[model samples]
Every structure is written in C-alpha cells, then in structure tokens.
Target: MNINGDYHVHTAFCPHGSNDKIEAYIEQAITKGLTELSFTEHAPLPKSFSDPTPDKDSAMKWADLDQYIQTIEKVKKDYQSQLKINLGFELDYIEGYESAITSFLNDYGSVIDDSILSVHMLKTNMDDYVCVDFSVEEFARIIQLFGSVEAVYDRYYQTLEKAIVADLGPYKPNRIGHLTLIHKYQRKYAVDQGYQFTIERLLDIMKKNKLELDVNTAGLYKEECLELYPPQAIVDLASQKGIPLKPGSDSHTAKTIARGFNKLSLLTNN
Candidate 1:
C-alpha cells in the first residue's frame, strides 16, 4: 500500500501518445515522489498480424524498436541516481501470435526491468480483430460484429484468460494489465453482473500463475468508466487471494504521471 512504483506507463514512442520528451516523464515521476517507473510503451505488433485500429497506431513502429531501446538505456544511466527507470513494453496478447510474442520476448526480455501483458485487440471473426477501447464508434461496431455488448465482454474476458495461461516462453510478463479494460465503456454499454463469475475465475487463474494485477487508475479518469479497472470489489478479492496489487496510472502524457494515485485504496488505506 506504500505505493512508490508505477509499472504501467507509455512514452513519446507511442504513436497514439503525446510528443512529450522521455525526460519529461521521469521529471514528473520524480516530482511526484515516485521512486520507480516503467516506460511500458506499446510494443510493435507481429509482422503477420494486421493492426485493426483505423489509424494503425496501436503500437510503436517496428523501425523505432532499436532506437527506443537505446534511448531508454541511456536514460536509465542518466537517472539512475534519482529514480528506478524500467525499460519495458505493454505487450499485446494476440491469440494466434504466441510464437512471435515468444520470439520477441526471448530477444529482449532479459533487458527489461518490468513489463505488462495486456489485451487491447479482440478477434471478432476468422481474420478480423477490433481494438476494443479505440472509441465509442469502434466499440459500437465491435458490438455489432459480436452481436451484443455481452458477447464482446465474453470474448474479451476469454482472451484475457488465454493470455494468462498461454506459454509465451519464460519471459512472459507476470503482471496482467487492466483486467477489466473491457468495461472502458460500461457507462455507455452497461455490463451485466454475470461477468463477476468470470472475473473470479480470472483471479483464480492469476493466483495460480502467481501473476500480479495492474490496479490501473486510468479508468477512473475516463468519463465512461469512473472506476478503477476491476473496481474495488475485485481489487479486494485480488488482495484476499494474495495477488500483488501494483498501482499504475497508465499515463500516456508526462503531466498525467501518477494521475489517479491518491484515489487508489492501496494508497489511501496506507
């Protein structure tokens, strides 16, 4: 509960994120008294997987991978005296691309200090996928693709379960990012209470795998989702299950670093 670390963060390298300099994020974290921060920028999607987002900005460009790594390495050295900067990625768990993900992790995992495996893309059909949190319009379209809001929720949670148990090699991230991200538009689409059973099952599997939960605060700030990802009930369940709860603002801009930290029960209780 003595929250001093933010394990989920994005950087300027993210095409969908701000153009803020990397140093700006570190400065903000230091100003906020955070001792540890991970620049878990979105990693590049697999070569064979076509990005479903309209702008195709879901992840960093494959061309920028090397430069991103080198820049973070230098930044790590520069800030080592003041902060613990982690080099990491917010990796997507595409159902069919496990091998490519494994290959990627095998190549770069050793250098990372922290990372998160998240589900942003959900397959809707044989060769088609949808970025579930892209926008209200996109969410509407996906609901149509899957035939209902409930079906979308079902598929999203199913994918999350698959990501948890799948063997993406030994370097697979131990933290599951934003477990209830499918609820991003809950105010608009309204989720049924039935999903609670599925969530409890997820926590069971997470405990089995010794996985951590990213108690993401970004959802609290989103107008459509005025609660933490998984909300308080699930957070309590995760805590009772002895799964580590790591607070993350999931900030995309430097100014938003530690954005909703104070509201976190983990922080408030302590």
Candidate 2:
C-alpha cells in the first residue's frame, strides 16, 4: 500500500481532533511520505448541529475555518517543496441540508480540490444533517445490538445507499471514507457470509455508479474490525469492478496518520 495521500484529516477546527496548527498536519504528512494530502475538517450544518457540540461550542467556527484555510494557503506557499496540500472538508449529511453545504461549497466549488460527504447519523429531521461523532458508549450499544458484521453491514450500507441517492451527484466524491467502520469495535459481531454477500452487492452498485473509494486505515486504531470500509471482500470486488482506490488514514489525531497500513497490505496480498 503505497499510500500517497492523507485525504481525511482533522485539526482544531473539527473540535474533536488535535489542536495543532494546520501546518503541523502538512508537515506530518510530508514526513509520512505523502505526495498529496487534503485537509478535510468537519463542516457541519450549523443550524442542524447541537448548540454545544461534544467538542466545540457550535458546529464549525467560521472564524477558525478561515484562519485554518489561510494557514494552509500560506504554508503551501512557504513550503512549496512539500506535498500538494489541498483544502476540503467532511461535509456532514443533512437530508434537506444540501443547500447549506452547497452554499458554503459554492464559494470554493470552482477552485477547491476535493470534498467528502459522510452520513454520520442514519436518521435526521428535515433534510438537514450534521456530522455527529458516534459516542464510544453509543458505538458500544450499536455493536452490542447490531455489531454482527452482517447486521452492521446491512445498516451501514443501507444508510450509504440513501446517501448516494440524496447526497452524491454532479460532484462525485473523490473517495468514500471508512466504508466498513461500523464494524470497527465488533469484528466478532460480524458473521462471514451475509456480511460478505451484502457488501458485494453494494460494491456492485458503487461500481455501476462509478464511484472511487479510499482504502481507510483508521480501523486499526480500534481493537477490532481492523479492515477498511466495506471490508476486504468488498474492496476486492471494487477492484474487480474497476473502481479506483487511494489509501486514506481517516486521521482524526495527528499522531496516528498512516498507522496500521500493513493490515491493508495483507488483505491486498491475499
């Protein structure tokens, strides 16, 4: 896995991630042997988000975002010799909330390099959705109830199907994040046959629709379900289907960038 780009990254702006400056992430990526990297901080639908978000006071502080962007632009100019740093964000899914995302994106839509739409939650009121991190407790509950890889796959992909229908269009995503991360804490919960078959069907759908995916390494950070999104079988199917793939860390913290890449290589080798 010659991982070239760290497309999924977060900084202080995301509230939950490291408080390090944007330049810190760029430097770390360069040291990790990245050729390209995009800074995709959490861009939540302000109104849809909780007033006091888990990590910050509000969804996304526009002030911090502007400063972060400015820092990235300046550092890109200053370093000039490092990776091709880009500005993008993990735009949370809001059903009718596309307008909010679209409006913000419109400013940079012309020149911005990339964007990733992630459905952090399954259900929402109205069309508006905000990126909400699954609490460890909630994740544990989900796993306890639906962690069987088969159950996890069923729900996650179904949600993904809805997302593809509602969110993805015109601007096709550069890559899908943590395709099978719902199983991260519950590999034992995932059964073999049903999970595999269902994911195969989803890969077929993505292939038919011509979507690219990132082979995420974030699962390794967890104690279980150490494979990338949609699992290895899905990845193989996607490969067979001619979907382009790029390795992504889904790095929420600065230290773990590019961690556990070997696990992905093992899957690829087999």
Lowest lDDT 10-residue stretch of candidate 2: 124-133
| Candidate 2, position 143, lDDT | 43
TM-score of 2: 0.80
Residue runs of model 1 more than 4 Å from their true location after superposition: 267-270
The RMSD (Cα, Å) of candidate 1 is 1.7
Output the worst ten-in-a-row residue range by lDDT, candidate 1. Answer: 261-270
Residue lDDT tens for model 1, 125-187: 666788999998899989988999999999999999999999998899999999999999999
Give the Å shift of residue 257 in candidate 2: 2.1
Estimated TM-score for each candidate: 0.97, 0.80
Give the lDDT of residue 267 in candidate 1.
34
Candidate 2 local distance difference test against the native? 0.62
Candidate 2 C-alpha lDDT tens digits along 1-270: 345677777777776566776667777777888788877777655454453234443235776766767766776677668678777777665444566666776665554566676656544223322223355555544445553435544656677765555544455455566666666656544456545666667667766666667677776656565556556666666776777676677776777676655566532321
Most accurate candidate by TM-score: 1
Query: All models: lDDT?
Result: 0.91, 0.62
lDDT score for residue 35 of model 1: 99
The local lDDT score (0 to 100) that residue 201 gets in candidate 1 is 94
